[model samples]
Target: MELTKEQLAFFDTFGFIKLSGLLKADITWITEEFEAVFPMLEEKHDGSKRTMIVPFADQREKLCSLVDDPRIAGIAKSLLGDDFNYMGSDGNYYTGDTGWHRDGENRARRHVKIALYLDALDGSSGALRVIPGSHRLDDKFGVDVKRVSQSQTALHVAGPDVPAVALDVVPGDVLVFDHNLFHASFGGSTHRRMFTLNLCERFGEDALDELRAYILLHAHFKREHYYGSAMLRSAGPERRVHLEQVDALCGDYAERTKDLPELPLKALI
Candidate 1:
């Protein structure tokens, strides 16, 4: 289940990699859990803007265990090391196009997203698109992309016209991409189902302040803990290694949010 050295190299160079049908056998259960989560929150996707539940997998035991799955853990360990931090999950019923953007503009930490798309898709049908090597900060190409893509005057084209790789996928496919990578999706149905597990390299004591800041940026989802109680209680030691770091640091979310503006209940796409 582990990625080969060459596969790792490909990711490091390209900013993403796709594993087709990697979770095919588990697709049935995964799909069921994916469907059950939204109902637990008493919210239904009405094919509107978007329906998102942060700490999505935390609502159900089966979904919580997704991060602990051997095949999934192997991918995280391969890229971010064994002591990676589990940065929570997001379940979505995606609507319309997602304009080009990176997750966190900070390029300091090694943050990666593992996306599980639950339907068939192609270049024109809401498939994920990524600009190759766009994650590199020092390269001229990356610099040009940052400059040109940011304004219509520079590129004179819309996001959908941007040059990129379209990653076509099916029910059981997994897509892992760098957080800095520029990505977007287009021409999709209103009720496209997908979920993501975010993981990143654990920070050292010297960099903990930076990590804390990153956690605060996303603290809108949690009340007191970064993860839900069900997610933590169901974890074994192996899974705890991934969840522990964020759990230890995110306890101050409520205190932090006291002075901040009110956050929307559901995350919009």
Candidate 2:
């Protein structure tokens, strides 16, 4: 996608953008397709495997095609750099019963999320809550917030005054967010929430390997910050090797995105 100067500037400052109706006719189809392949996620604390299953069987291929859309992936590449990779996908429905947290440590690279809302999302409907521009805080923290899963009561620390933006996502709208941004969603009593996730630029050669390894050994990589419970974490060397193998599949993704023509939003509609 060709990002206007203002759009680019917004992402740099706010850490996310809600692009309306990003799904269109394919919304129901994609959701149904992904649900068919959705696996029961292990209730581990770490962020690994939490988003492992891609709805389409040929997930990597479909992602490449989707990301190549000029209005979508092209802009992602522009902000995230051309070395982007398709790291994982997730389907989430919130109860609004939970509070705040971040996905920093779970992601393997500098991550950005292409969140396509399949249905309307609002506070009452368990819509997403975000700390805008949280992504920009990474450099100051001495750690990439993307890699930090815990900050000891950071949820409470974030407090109530932190302005909570209720996303009014029409079906087909897409939201691009920095993975490190501090955001959370409440659950809906009815209507399932669905979205496609993409992570850009694999920083380390062994990043995927590390993920695969962690998953195999630990079955869960627990992150205590958000859940206030253990989610999942890596374990043992044998699993680490397995993680390496799984990571290999993603290695070529960056190369694939290099020269494609942009997919504009107008064409998508």
RMSD of each: 2.0, 12.8
Clashes of 1: 0
TM-score of each: 0.93, 0.60
lDDT of 2: 0.51
lDDT for each residue of candidate 2 in 1-269, tens digit (9 for 90 to 100): 65678988998787788877655756676666555444434332132212333322233333334544556656666776655554445444422233555555444456677777666767657566677766665456324333223433443333333456767677777888887677766555433455555555645654646654533332122221111111113213332232233344434433443443232111110
- Which residue segments of model 2 deviate by more than 4 Å? 38-64, 105-109, 138-161, 204-269
Best candidate, TM-score-wise?
A: 1
lDDT of 1 at 58: 82
Candidate 1 displacement at residue 210 in angstroms: 1.4
